[model samples]
Target: MLIWRLQKRVLNFVHVPPPHCGVDIVDAIYKCLKECGLKNKVFTVSMDNASYNHSCLRFLREIFSRNRRLLCKGKLFHVRCCAHILNLLVQDGLGEIGHIIENVRESVKYINQYEARKQTFSKIVQQLQLGTKKLVIIDFPTRWNSTFQMLLCALKFKDVFPRFQGRKPNYDYLSTPEEWKNVEKVCEVLEVFNVVTNIIFDSDYPTSNFYLSEIYRVKEILNLKAMDESDFIRRMVGKMKGKFDKYWGECNLLMVVASVMDPRCKLRLAEMFFPKIYSEAETRNNIEQVRGDLYQLYMSM
Candidate 1:
């Protein structure tokens, strides 16, 4: 899903996993990197959890428990996943919106069950599809997307929901307008994919993480005022709400926190946030002096 080939050009990175082939995938990734001759050019590591750290001391100590050989060489950082913090914020938010959340979850279960409803769903997509049969399913690792999709599905099914009461839409159930609403929400996500994609690469904002655009996207979903938004936005939001924010926010937060915790942000962030710092220097001779002075000023802050 990393469309930009971040590993290929990213020089540095962070990884977080609740273990869907986490350790092994990380190893295979790096091994492939070595075969591709990237081992020495980029710094990479598997960011461990609280248990992985509390059972030990210091970053190296925690990481060493996983790969003993890394104790001597190789680079790494063991830090918390920042995006999960946001997921916690959302999960805890259910207490504030429990009814809405439960409704959304039920709607998602309805849509994802089987092909007939899905076919009806596909028909709706064809009607509103603009021009494509291909659509991304609201997936798990994409918690934010799921969260958005859920609410959308619930809203889409609002009309028929009264009929079912508690019957629950089974996989073979025929699609309803409510369900179609949810399907459109998925399309909405596709609509904004490019805008959100830009935030990650624009290098022009105060914040560049994917979630920044995501926050804006969610706000748009929550607040869009098209007449019969239920016919449009709510369904889209339900379809996407599930894991969209949760996963992206979880993963992205880790990256931000890693950047913050690196102790290198002072040096690196300056170069990134202030391009002039590099381009406007008086002389090459003063580069290190300027870098040191800037770093010191940052440290004091």
Candidate 2:
């Protein structure tokens, strides 16, 4: 995919052969750029945080620099995929509640497998007078956001589940009362992630400046929930916070630069919020660094 002049489009669809290593990826990318006569026009590459991608960038930077086409010595050449990072964070949290998700997922699958079961579940929904028209969703294991949606939808029809279980007499995946309570709390926590994920994935506009603020909101949620009275919530949030720090504890320089460039934020956002995420001394140093980087980038351009 390529983004040029605010327009995004796929420039090549090369088939990567077995052992898609960094050299192979760079070969494919270089071939495409050469064919398009764009070898010297490239600015940056946005990719997921895969280890091989780092290798790919290193090779590409060397090639571009040898040709004297690398801007700012390729300091801003790699942009980590934000959506992918968000997925890792949520998946970390979900790992702590796998059993609860499995039970809900299995219950949904059982209900969806046969027409008779679907009809019976529908009838139970009617009898219980559940005020929702949404059905239980069977989420795939790979997509954590789908799991979030499945849990959110299932919670709406949670009362109908017991009624359906009573009729079947053989159903085994219905969550216990305490488990249901946990699911509700987890759903509340995941709602913020869901909303921010949507905002990040929005394709109608450029979202770079929006990232730092959304990420800050997520940190606030994790820190607040990590101190909750419920041991379950606290434990779950602890795992999530660990993952969050692994990826985002230190500010990503590119993201901070973008935030500083936004007229609305423009240093003030960093000044106002850095203290919340970092110690006073670190915040002061970080703000100064970002300010200096901003000026250096402008001068280089």
Candidate 3:
């Protein structure tokens, strides 16, 4: 993929024959870049948080280094996809509520399965005057955001579910009142992730500060919710926070430097937020590191 002046294009799509190892992947990328006369013009490579991807970056970096085409010694050459990381975090949270999701998903499926069931549910919706044109959404299990939308859309019809259960005695997927309450809380939490994911994917070439500020908002929410009195909410937050730290615990150096470079933020955002995210000592050290890295990147240019 190539981006210039806010325009992005996929230059090539290569298929690696089985055993997609780091060497094989790099070879394909190298061939494509050279074919496009972009071998020496390459900058950063953005990919998901897969073990194979790290290996691929390592191999690609060595090849570029051998040709003396590495920028800033390849320090900023690998970018972990933010949307992917956010997806992982949401998936983690969903794992805690899998049973709840399954119940909701099955209910939606049952309602949409047959025309009779659909008519029956719609009559109930109309009787209750739910006034929502949005039908119950069935989610793709693999994509948790779809699950989030499923839950969110389901919440609107929470009042109608139990009523429908009475008419359809065979329908056994209605969530208990307690579980329904938990679902509401879970949707509240997942809403943040859903919004961030949409922003990252919807926008074109968002800057580093744009990424940092959005991620920082997620961090703040997690920290605040981690201390919630409800055990269910706390437990759900725990799983999500673990994944968050895995990808974001150590701030990405490139994003930090880029954030500091943004005129709207400069050093102030880092200085103000570092203390909230890290230890006092760690905060000071990180701010200094960002300062040092920023200077090096500017001087090298």
Top model by TM-score, which number? 3
* Model 2 steric clash pairs: none
- What local lDDT score does residue 152 receive in model 1, on the 0 to 100 scale? 49
Q: What alpha-carbon RMSD in Å does predicted model 2 have with respect to the real structure?
A: 2.9
Candidate 2 minimal-lDDT segment of 10 residues: 68-77
Candidate 3, residues 1-301: lDDT per residue as tens digits?
Answer: 7544576779898999987788889999999999999998878999997778889999988888888746556778998888888888888877887887889999999999998888888888899888884465789998988888888888889888899899999999999888898898888888888787776678667655667777888998899889987787888789989998888888678777777768788888888878888889989888887788777778877
lDDT of 1 by residue, 116-210 (tens): 54555545556554343322344342354465544443444444443443343443334455545544544454335434544544554334234
State which candidate has the highest lDDT: 2
The TM-score between candidate 1 and the true structure equals 0.35
Q: Estimate each model's TM-score.
A: 0.35, 0.92, 0.94
Instruction: Estimate, for each residue in 1-301, the C-alpha lDDT of model 2 and write its tens digit.
Output: 7554567778989999977799999999999999999998888888987878989998998998899755445667877788888888888888888888899999999888888888888887777777664375889888987998899889888888888898898889989989999998899889999989888786677778878888889999999899888887888888889988887777677777778778788878777778988888888888887777677788867
Candidate ranking (TM-score, best to worst):
3, 2, 1
Candidate 3 global CA lDDT score: 0.83
Candidate rank order under lDDT: 2, 3, 1
> What lDDT would candidate 2 get against the real structure?
0.84
In candidate 3, how many Å is residue 83 off?
Answer: 0.9
Mark the regions of model 3 whose C-alpha exceeds 4 Å error after superposition.
1-4
